[model samples]
Target: MNITIYDVAREAGVSMATVSRVVNGNPNVKPVTRKKVLEVIDRLGYRPNAVARGLASKKTTTVGVIIPDISNIFYAELARGIEDIATMYKYNIILSNSDQNAEKEIHLIHTMLGKQVDGLVFMGGQISQEHIEEFEHSSVPVVLASAIEPTGKIPSVNIDYRQAAADAVAMLTDAGHTDIAFVASPLKDTINQHVLSGYYEALEAAGIEKKDELVIEGDYTYDSGIEAWSRLQELSSPPTAVFVNNDEMAVGVIHGAQDNGVHIPDELEVISFDSSRLALMVRPQLTSVVQPLYDIGAVAMRLLTKYMNKEKVETPIVVLPHHIEKRGSTK
Candidate 1:
């Protein structure tokens, strides 16, 4: 019988992600979990190197990855997953940052194509027509992580941004916060737009009138989040709770409220998206929507491998699950 990671995980009562982290030497896994997974691996004789074992005679190719910013913890986590899988598949990664700029993204695509990369993995906020054109013209397979391609023409891996955002807002609404505010990333980005719609959807469902001033635009930075919070404070009817787009911005909002002598989850409840490591690092740790960032990247790379090898693919679009992680920041 073939031993697989899934079998190992099932035996150990852990997630496949935990097994992957243990195999990949990711430090985030709890010590007990790591020990358990390692024990299961030893007992089951399971190896995660099945791809390499099968492709012993395969040539080592390259996969070009275009990211928005590596400095962001969210992107950094995703990058780690991509690199690990690429390494397992004996594919070298040529990484570049596009900074979520359209022209730069387009140029990177052409440049990666010029290098004859075997595949491409892209992460960005919006998928413009130019991007679609480039993807259509590219000879190599392309996949997106944490990006939504409206046309469904491109293969991608991501979570349901809309439903996650709705859940965040609804959580606050359930806590009896009628005056909830939102610190959003740029609405121009499709992901943010989806989140925006979900925010309204939640408000509409609760019969709470959406206040215009409560929706503040942010640049997905700590400073932007602080500024958004500051603007909300200046309002005649300040928000009792705020939903931020990402962890960094959420931390900024928390600190901003603290600086003004507002106690978290007391005077100002908060919820944010992307429960990255930064979420736990902050004081009064954030209650956030946990996005399986690494999983998204890992799955996207795996899918690209399928295309590169001309294997059968069942789905071109994949939506991973996301859920709320309640913590000190929310009631």
Candidate 2:
């Protein structure tokens, strides 16, 4: 009652080796042979035994993806892209959340490696030297997706955060907003530092004196954004426009301002990064930068696959493009 490779081969009038090649997705098989073998396999309801095949070939044909938070729309969309591409390549994905903790991330890496994943796609706020060292010694291929490690040795796919942030600020300045504020998470992270630097650079270019009072830090959460707005409002002269590091915080800022009787765009303009779905969900849709998070994840997975196959990759670092999507939040 159970069907196997032998049944498929016998039905197709082909040798077992030829059936094996067809099942493994080999391109050398002639089209007619492939079609005939597939028809036989389908008719017999024979399925390839992935576990047995992996034991023989030492490859699981699976990818492990680790992200900081899947609740965030940005990361959720990114994971979708990775899954789509992995499915295309006949591979499966094992997804996990690291909560952006370095120790937890390292532990997850070891666990995934123990499971013998063919490759890994990692995304987090900060990657420590220990992580880099572990990855350097890893037998499997690893790629950073929307995350940057301190060491530039690992392959990565991301947009130019510094440039993207700078461009957003420049746009705000050109729109006649002289007084601006930069709201971000901790600057200890390298990516956050680059974004903040861009904000400062744009202000300098526009001849606007940088005000320390206007620079506030949030934890990239909606609650933290509310706190940041409260702190900014207490200042002697509040900023007319604010650049938030993420859409979650931007939503909080918008709501917080409205609660304090401040009108968006007319009284206070807000811009955030990562044009996630939440950007459109807000009452006054957030004007934000598009990070192309999905593309970053997909490309990183592709690069890891190439590395796993011992193929030459064209580039170690792939920088995707980003742009601003204007909406109701910004003038």
Q: Using lDDT as the measure, which candidate wins?
A: 1
* Backbone clashes in model 2, listed as residue pairs: none
lDDT of 2 by residue, 1-331 (tens): 8788888888899998899888888899999999999988888889887655666679989788989898878899999989988998888898999988888999999988887889899898877788889889987889998888766899999999999999999999999988898889777777898899999999999999988888888888999898899998988888899999999999999999999999998999999999988999998999999998778878887888789888899899999999999999987
Candidate 2's TM-score reads: 0.86
| TM-score of every candidate relative to the true structure | 0.82, 0.86
> What's the count of clashing pairs in each model shown?
0, 0
Estimate the Cα RMSD of every predicted model relative to the unseen true structure.
13.1, 3.9
lDDT of 1 by residue, 1-331 (tens): 8888789989999887788778877899999989989998999999676334224324337899999999999999999999999999988899999998999999999998776678999999999998998998888899999998789899999999999999999998998989999999999999999999999999999999988999999999999988998999999999999999999999999999999999998899999999999999998999999999999999999999999999999998999999999999987
What C-alpha lDDT values do all the predictions have?
A: 0.91, 0.89
- The local distance difference test score of model 2 is 0.89
Give candidate 2 misplaced runs (Cα > 4 Å): 1-52
